[model samples]
Target: MWGRRPARGTIVKICGLRTIDALEASIEAGADLAGFVFFEKSPRHLTLDAARALVARAAGRIGMVALTVDADDERLAAIIAAIQPDFLQFHGHEAPERVREAKARFKLPVIKAIGVGGREDLVAAKAYAEADMILYDAKPSPGAARPGGMGRAFDWGLLNEAPREKPWLLSGGLSPETVAEAVRITGAPGVDVSSGVESAPGQKDPSRIAAFLHAARGAAGGEAR
Candidate 1:
């Protein structure tokens, strides 16, 4: 099982990476996790073959996260077989039972994403007792095309009084300019970013990745130069 916090610094995840350059930038920038989207609707979506190539290149270099949206057994198996991801992020409307089932069936740690717009959303997280980690992302607007990675953020203050058990990451609306405040406000053990570091939709920016990592590290009292 994953712990509630990293042993040293605040964990940073760079999500929606689709190219070797983005992957390399995350590695060089000292990001703790590298995420790839599998949802076809997402602009950052990667095909199985593309995922395989990137996974091969990232082998043993950083932690890999396979982000999916309410995937069935076959889709999960195919992705797992191809990328062998270290973590599976359920970024859809999957119930706690599904999360528990997927974790057990796949023998991989699960990061359950909760869309938080208010305190009511935080209450829903309590039901996911079996999740290895929790990601608090901004809730998508009505009729949004995608679930996450939209660069929208909710009120960080909403988490001020929320209690935590397992490891959790603060996502949505995070960027190089705002990560420090997000970290300071939430005291989150980890942070995840996608559109925040992109030059355009689905295009990861190396410089932005580096800057975000530096800011997050500085906020966490780690080596940030």
Candidate 2:
């Protein structure tokens, strides 16, 4: 199922950051990217001004990714105008055509998220190969209040048997303790965390962010050929 090895070090992303301290900690902990949630329903969501400030602090020190769910063109345009994030992450039910359209319209690299609960979910990822990257998150159950950051984990073994040609990230219920295992199991080039690094919903814990990065780096170094 694996196509190519990720770089020697696992690309770490600390997501759902809402504070300057958390943002700085991510960079200090060696995170490759930091994610800002823009979905209002999510407790981690950030306003335009807040997001812009956070992005400014990052200042190209690390990749800044804006997470949205099925946002319309106008909203996306406004966000692009404000923060000009390095990447746009779509976590909604956007189709491949929409992914193509959004990429073309914004002229930004896109990371399409796929919710994986079982084998069927892997099939859904096939349609998004055209995307610059794919994020594999746990599927939300029916009537769930939020789409992701639920701190739930799907079967990592499911990905071990799937076919993948594009770079991808493994997310969902990942914490400092389990990130290494997730990387070892899926061989993901990147791993994303939100709730795992939080002391409470929407509240980031800097210590957890540091530990997660350290553990992920160690695991990536110890992987066998």
TM-score of each: 0.97, 0.94
List candidate 1 stretches off by more than 4 Å. 1-8
Where does candidate 2 stray beyond 4 Å? Answer: 1-8, 222-225
The local lDDT score (0 to 100) that residue 215 gets in candidate 2 is 86
lDDT of 1 by residue, 55-105 (tens): 988989999999999999999999999999999999999999999899889
Overall local distance difference test of candidate 2: 0.86
Residue 127 in candidate 2 has what lDDT?
A: 84
lDDT agreement with native, every candidate: 0.91, 0.86
Model 2 per-residue lDDT tens digits across residues 141-215: 988877863889999989986656777889997999999999889887789999998999989998998899888
